[model samples]
Structure formats: structure tokens, C-alpha cells
Target: MDYANKTGGSAQKKKSFAGNKAALIFFLLTVPTLLLYIVFFLLPLGMGAYYSMTDWDGFSLSYRFVGFKNYIDILQDNRFLHSVRFTFLYATIVVVLKLFIALVLAIFLSGKLKLRGFFRSVYFFPAVLSMITVGLIFNQIFYSVFPSIGQALGIDWLSRNILGNKSTAIYGIALTNIWHGIATPMVIFIAGLASVPKDLKEASLIDGATPLQRFFSVTIPFLIPMLTVNLVMAIKGTLTVFDYIVAMTDGGPAFATESMGFLIYKHGMAEMKFGYGTAEAIYVFVMIAIISFIQIKILNRKEAGQL
Candidate 1:
């Protein structure tokens, strides 16, 4: 009887020990990452929320709570509203132009052509350069080379720097963004093209479809996933574009190139209006979240419909 009882007790202990072992392994795997995320992302976000409710100029140690006054004031600020409008315009133009160019380049490079590898490398080379460096180089070209060329050719508009005009400064910045941003989507589309089934294209050709028809029907359908990814990334990156604009225009010609990001940096870091800046930052965060969510849903819905 004692041996029987001891055997049952030993079996129960083994099962309990096994459960503990599994729990420890799970905790070991997840706890470190969980703690890091809380420390780095969540904690700072909470503190930012707290700061946004106070009237804290960054230089002052003591601050008073001001409720939603900053938020109310920001809504009435014309400059901030203008920056919002400019940001949307710039992001839309850049995303559309960049994706279109990248898609074209990808299709071209995927075909049978001479020195294809070299051309692919050349196209992708700009992406590796720092945005600031790209912006500076373009700035010099716009300011000096283009003007001289235009003067020699007697072209009226190009005779002067476009960045000097408020009407054209944002367009110039958009052009710079497109120049540097195309390579990433190009690479992604190339991968998508390569993964497309050769048999399908052969079947389309057998069905007497033209090259254009095959491209639209076969290639584009296959590329939808990649397009979705690129769309979200492009929107997010273009909206937060600050460094390039700063390096190129410094939001010049009466703050014509100013994006929400630039405004946030100017108010928070440069002007020391920490509370107002934080409120603005929060507004930007919410805007980005809504935009991203909508894009993802639409793209995902399209993908589902296609399938």
C-alpha cells in the first residue's frame, strides 16, 4: 500500500514539475522583450501625455496644468493648419510619383536587356545615401547648376532657383523625395516580378494577350501584396519627412515646405513650447494612426477581393 501511494505521489509531482518548466520557458522568452517595450515605448508615451496637459516650456522646471487649452489653441493656429495642408499635398504627390516611377523602373529592369545588372545597381544606389546628403546635393544643383543652365538657354522660369518661391518650393522638395525614395519600391517590385509563375505568363501569351494586357492582368495582380506594403511605408515615411526638407529648404520661402514634423520640432525643441509641442505631436500621432489604419484596411480589402 505504501509503495502504491508513493508511486502516485511521484507521478503527480512529475506532472507539476513539467508544468513549472514550461511556464519558466515561456516567461524567459517573453518577459525581456515585454519589459523593454514598456520601458522604451509605453513609459515615454505616458510621460508625453502627462506633459501635454501642462504648460511647460522646456526650460522651466515648474509647470501648471492647463487642461485642453493647448489643443484648443493649436486648432486655431493658421500656421499649423497650413502646415497640415502642405504636408498632405506633399505626401500625396511624392507617394504617387515615387511608386509610379519605381514600378516602371522595376518592369524595365526585369526584362531582357543589355547591362541590366549595372542599371539596377545604378537605380538603387541613391537609396543608400543619407537623405540629408541627397537633399544637400539636390539643393546645390537646384540653386547653382540649373540656374546657370537655364540662364545659358534663356529659359525664364529656370533662370532662378525654384526653391526661392513659396509656390514652387514644396514641389521642389517633392521632386527630391521622389528621386531618393523610388529605389526601395523598385527593389520590392522586382522581387514580386521574379516570384511570378513563368507558366502563367506563357499561358497568357498562348491566349493571344498583348504584352500590355499580360502586364496588367498577370503582373499587377501578382504584385498587389508588394504594392500594399510599399503604399503604407511610403505614406508613413513621406508624412514624417523632416530631415530632407530641413537640409534642402529649411522650410524656406515663408515656411512653404513646413511639414507637421518640422512644426513639431520647431515648437518643441527650438521654441521651447514643450506643452504645446507635445499636444501637436499627439495630434500628429493620431493623424498618422488614422491614416495608416485606413490605408491598411483598404489595401487588405482589395487583396481579399483579388483573391
Candidate 2:
């Protein structure tokens, strides 16, 4: 009996030692990432939060703490408010267009079509291009190619520079963004569609289900996760749009296309209203966090329901 207890205790000790070693390995593997996150992300975020309460210009050696004045001023700023509104409108347009177009393209491309490989490569080619490069190319296209074609077609609207018009500039920018953004989401949708069970689709078809009915019933359930991922990406990308605006419009045509991201850059870096810009940046961070959280929650619930 004593021998058995001793043996059992020895086995337990060995098991405990193995578990400790695994935990140590995990800690060692994760520590570097944790340290980097703290240093790069958390540290900067904490400093930005602290600076938002102050009146520090970018080059200042010293500054005074104003305590939420920047936040209050931003809240009342009409230009900032307009930028926020414009960003929302742009996001809505871009997100809808991207998801719809990507879904259609994905569905078509996933089928057995001749030259499918070539078409997929062509569709995905835009995603590999630099956003700035794409923006510049589109800028020239809008300025030169579009107007020439428009004039040839006798279309007055197309003949004019769309980016130069206050009302139409947002659409031009949205078009550029959509052109670049659709590739990634389309690939994602294709992957999701690929994962859909062949048997289920065949069964649905055998049941005399129409293409639209099969899509709504079987295909859509499988694509829900992809939809959620694309939605989140689209929202975040569009909400913080800056590069395209800089390349295409520079928030031009009477600041009609000014986005929150560009506004923050202009104020914080260019204008040297460091404290104010930091406040605006913090506000944007909070807004994004809340929206993302709510979106994830809603989508997760829907995903669970589908399951």
C-alpha cells in the first residue's frame, strides 16, 4: 500500500512538472508580444490621452492643462461635425457598394466559367496595388479619361470633373475606394462560398429550389461569417479614410469630402494643434470601439441564430 502511494505521488509530480514546463513555454512565447504591445500601442495611447487634456502645440517644450476644453471645442466645431457626417455618408455608400458588388462577383467567379483563373487574377489585381498609387491613377482617370469619354458620348456630367463639384466629389471618391476595396471582400466571399457544402446545394436544387431561393436559404447562412468580417473591415476602413482623399481630392471642393482621419491629420500634424487633434483622435477611437463592439455583438448573435 505504501509503495503504491509513493508511485502515485511520483506520477503526480511528473505530471505537475510537465504542466509547469508547458506554461513556462507559453509565457516565454507570449511575453515578447505583450511587451511590444505595451510599448508601442498602450504607451502611445496613454500618452495621447494625457496630451488631449493639455494645450501642447507639436513643437512646444511646455504646455498648460486645459482639462477637456479641446473636447468641448471639437463638439461645437461645425467643420468637425460636417466631417463626421460626411464620413458616415461615405462609409455607408462604400460599404453597401463593396459588399453587394463583391458578393455578385464572388458568386459568379466561384462557378465553373472559362478563363476563371484569369478573371480571378484580374479582379484581385487591384488589391495588390498601393492605395496611394491607385488613388493617383484614378485621379488622372477622372481628370482626363472620364471627361474625354464624357465629351465623346455627349454626356455633360461626365465631361465635367466630378471631383471638382462639391455634390459629386464624394461619389467620385467613393468610386475610387470601391474599386480598390472590393477585391479583398470578393476573395473572402469566394472562400466562404467554396466552404459551402456541395451536398446541401445539390439537395436544395433537387428540391426544386430556384437559384435565388437556394442563395437565400443555404448560401447566405454560410456567408454570414464572411459578411461580418467584411462589414467590420469596410466600416473601419471607410470611417478612417485618409489616403485616398489626400491622393484624389485633398478634401477639396469646399471641404465637402473632408473625413475624420484627414481632419485629424490636418489639425494635429499640419496645423500643429496637437492637443486639439489628440482629443479628436481619442474621440474617434472611442467611436470606433463602441461601434465595433456593438456590431460584433449583433453579428455574433445573428451567427449563433443561424447555427
Q: Best TM-score goes to which candidate?
A: 1
lDDT of 1 at 141: 91
Worst 10 residues of 2 by lDDT: 1-10
lDDT string for model 2 (139-184, tens) is 9999999999999999999999999999999999999999999999
Predicted structure 2: lDDT: 0.93
- Cα lDDT of model 1 by residue, 1-307, tens digit: 3333445556776665665665688679999999999999999899888889888999887999999999999999988999899999999999999999999999999999999999999999999999999999999999999999999999999999999999998888899999999999999999999988999999999999999999999988889989999999999999999988888898878988889999999988998899999999999999999999999999989889977
Model 2 — TM-score against the truth?
Answer: 0.90
Off by over 4 Å in 1: 1-15
Candidate models: Cα lDDT each: 0.91, 0.93
